[model samples]
Target: MSQPSPQPDRAAGHNPRSSGPGRLIIALYAVFVVGSLSRAGFQIATRFQEAPLAYTLSALAGVIYVVAAISLALPGPRAWWVSLAAISTELVGVLAVGLWSTLDPAAFPDATVWSGFGRGYLYIPLVLPVVGLWWLWSTRPGTVQD
Candidate 1:
């Protein structure tokens, strides 16, 4: 008679690799995803014609945030790569839009998610992408893989 094999520890819902900061990051990303998407929906539905460029940009940012959030929540190398790409694009978008809005207020006329470095959101939009990129890099294969 052989002894039974021990089941893998699954005490918490969280994966072993996704404790602490990783979970926190994921939660924040989820919040941003929802916020961006909701804002974009409102902007596009209510007054898209008023500032087409800004509204379009808002929509794009929302999509990117959603993708990044989902990718980060998933567990795999592919997800990591996708999240990295999304976050990098987000960083570039925020920087470019922030500078453009600052240099020429008339150009915006209406604010996008990246306008003024996301001042409306207290610059979290600007900083989030940087943190996300770092997190993804840290979780890369051959690294911690979290």
Candidate 2:
């Protein structure tokens, strides 16, 4: 006499990461996608000879941002795993590049998105992955009790 109920996950507090603050994280990722890609595009196009390594690294960071954003927005266990990988990579990238750039400034005359621990962008790129990883782990499937 009545229609079927919604999915159990929805009825419970097992919300999707794409919802709530997760959306904010995704939005931040989108911003990084634009910033990193545009910067890389401009550098690679107009000043490739000036700083090829930095520009290329920026482009790579942009691609990683794109992947992380999409994976976070997607809904599924597979997507969660992908988001995990992408965010982990981003973290490692920021840390490694931060140290490398700090140690060898000459190697990077310019700056990638991950350089200086994202100091150019107020270090958001450095902290974003940590937040994302925390969000994912906390909101992981079946973890929400309420």
Candidate that would win on TM-score: 2
TM-score of 1: 0.84
lDDT of 1 by residue, 58-115 (tens): 8898888888877877766667788889899999999999999999988888998899
TM-score for each of the candidates: 0.84, 0.89
Candidate lDDT values, in order: 0.80, 0.90
Residue-wise C-alpha lDDT for candidate 2, range 23-72, written one tens digit per residue: 99999999999999998999999989999999999999999999999988
Candidate 1: regions farther than 4 A off: 1-18
Task: Note the residue pairs that clash in candidate 2.
Answer: none
TM-score of 2: 0.89
Q: Which stretches of model 2 miss by more than 4 angstroms?
A: 1-15
- Root-mean-square deviation of Cα positions for candidate 2 versus the true structure, in angstroms: 3.5
Error of 1 at 116 (Å): 0.5
Total clashing pairs in model 2: 0
